[model samples]
Target: MPETFLEVGIAFAGIALASLVAAQLRFPSIPLLIVAGILLGPAVMSAVDELRLMQVFAGFGIVLILFFLGLEFSVGDLLSGARRKVLNGLLDFAINFSLGLAVGLLLLDLSPLGALFVAGIVYISSSGLIARLIFELQRAARVETGLILSILVFEDLVIAGYLAVLSSVSGGTEEAASFLQPALALGIVAATIGTARFISRGAQRLLERIVSDELFVVAIFAALVLVAGLAEMVHISSAIGALLLGLILAETGHVERIEQRLRPVHDIFAGVFFLHFGLTIRLENIQAVLAAAAVAAIISILGKTATGLLAGRIAGLSFPASLTAGLTLIPRGEFSIVLAALAVSAGLSPLIGSFTAVYILILAVAGSLLARESLRIAAWVESLRRPKGNTTSG
Candidate 1:
């Protein structure tokens, strides 16, 4: 860690600067932080030379990200939306994933599993980016806002299942094909989540006795990490373990205390995670993948657009609002990077990493600009549908 101090320090500095820029621009920080990492990291200027240590720390970053994501929604919330939105979520996954798979196989020349990774990368839209857009674009009060957020919620649950089948207990061994043990992995994840919720029956009584904030932090933090470690031991993804831990602990009704005490730690590690991923990208490598990334981005947008439109129609939204929803769902971030890291661990082509980096840059920047103008675009579309006799003179 001492030798790693320079690399670590530079990473945080990049994170700070990126955050400031994103804040000033009133934009989401994901893209800024990622670009900062790429520009400041080894591939470009060799500012942060070593990666082994940062890789270790970034592990904590991902576990925390997945855990906190789980905390934001509860089991009841998932159950409540299962009937109405589950089909829409499935449609979203199918459309984007199919497009990604075809592109990965045909254009990128990836194998089935690697193509699965690509599909995963394209399947889910960026929840953090979209949430910020909803706020900054002043669409928080709009009806479509709730629909968008609901899609995110549904996607979160879907990913839990997707990752379950996609993960292997052996970490990322290349020979260990993940598809070989779907039943076992899903069984383990289901059992672990079930066990956590079952234990929550008495968790409240235990948590209430921890009167000191410091003690509570230590105790709860230990529990979260311990569950994650144990899950990893059994060949389940540690991230899933962290998520299940959050799901179970949420029922304890102490979520507010846990979030308040631990969020800063989560934020710090999250920055490290994104920044480290950025550093691993090779610019020359990106050039080889850039064309593929561009085509993938276009296909991804079209797929998501179709899903959003069909879902909107099923939910009885107006045509313009449907188009707006489709456009806003164009961006992908966070989880896609996480998937690429997992692929690297699984010994997939290193090109996958560069490919993801380029794809994210294209979508995050282009997608935001498109989302901001989507409403205007939708209004124009609606105007096109108007009758000439009904047109008003300006």
Candidate 2:
């Protein structure tokens, strides 16, 4: 099932076009690319079999995306949050993960591990999607918005922990000391930051003295991929490593330039990743698990909504703001897809894989719409909260 170059080209081209359409329609581009993949891949147009390569590309995209996100992480910002973001994130994770597991066991008859996988799917949300929507809704600077994003960041850490645990369990590796992995992971992060800081500072000097912007950008990507590979070799997730790398360089004078230069490549590869994910979804498998998919979607949405609101209230957000934050966090993206792929590869029942894909698609769409509507509600609430002297009612 090797793909010809032409097939790969067509598949990607279709994705790009579809994503443009999705943006114009104000829909999530990832799902649109998924639709593109479904149409262009063997199940329909039969245009490509390059999914293996696409998978590799997707992995890189995830790593890069995390790295960029990490660059945005600042200890100062976290400390300034009125509520502890980590605790807020943890509360949301615990509530939603537990509910997801309970639903899996009660409704799907899954074993503990399978139930854990289901919980992982529901616990992880698409930060990229949510961030974009927040910006579009003009809610990015809201106090509640900060809380929501912080929680999302913490959730990523939780997802990383779970992934490590799941990988160890599936691999039948001896459980090392609980603290060992986190210690090693943290050590790697610290080292990455130190190195990146040095490079970022020196790189600008080097570039001003000799290197061109184009050459500097190329070197940055090369460093990113190289560091990511090293992190994987050390048994740490490359995503975390890359994030540390980015953070180290975040304070560099070149932050804006580096981000801008990297955007195009990130956008292109990310599209391929989402498109490949969508394309690989087997409609037949989904058909077989439609009942389970429907149930999973409902539980995930409701649980996430409930958890988001609870966590928001605790974080001092108003009801409408809390509700919007909750809805914004419901779409499972890269992490959910990665978990599904891992489950299938680890020989979990095929039904789990099928169920995840269908469930994710359903939730992503519904969750996006819910987030949009919640934003509107939040805006309305904010208006209502304004002084009567400052407002005119229709």
- The numbered model that scores best in lDDT is 1
For model 2, how does the per-residue alpha-carbon lDDT over 56-90 read when each residue is reduced to its tens digit?
A: 88777777776777667544443466357767877
Task: Give candidate 1 misplaced runs (Cα > 4 Å).
Answer: 169-180, 193-196
Q: Please give the range of 10 consecutive residues that has the lowest summed lDDT in model 2.
A: 73-82
The TM-score of candidate 2 is 0.82
Q: How close is every model to the real structure, measured as TM-score?
A: 0.94, 0.82
**What's the CA error at residue 3 for candidate 2, in Å?**
5.9
The true-versus-predicted C-alpha distance at residue 99 of model 2, in Å, is 2.0
Best candidate according to TM-score: 1
Model 2 misses residue 366 by how many Å?
A: 1.5
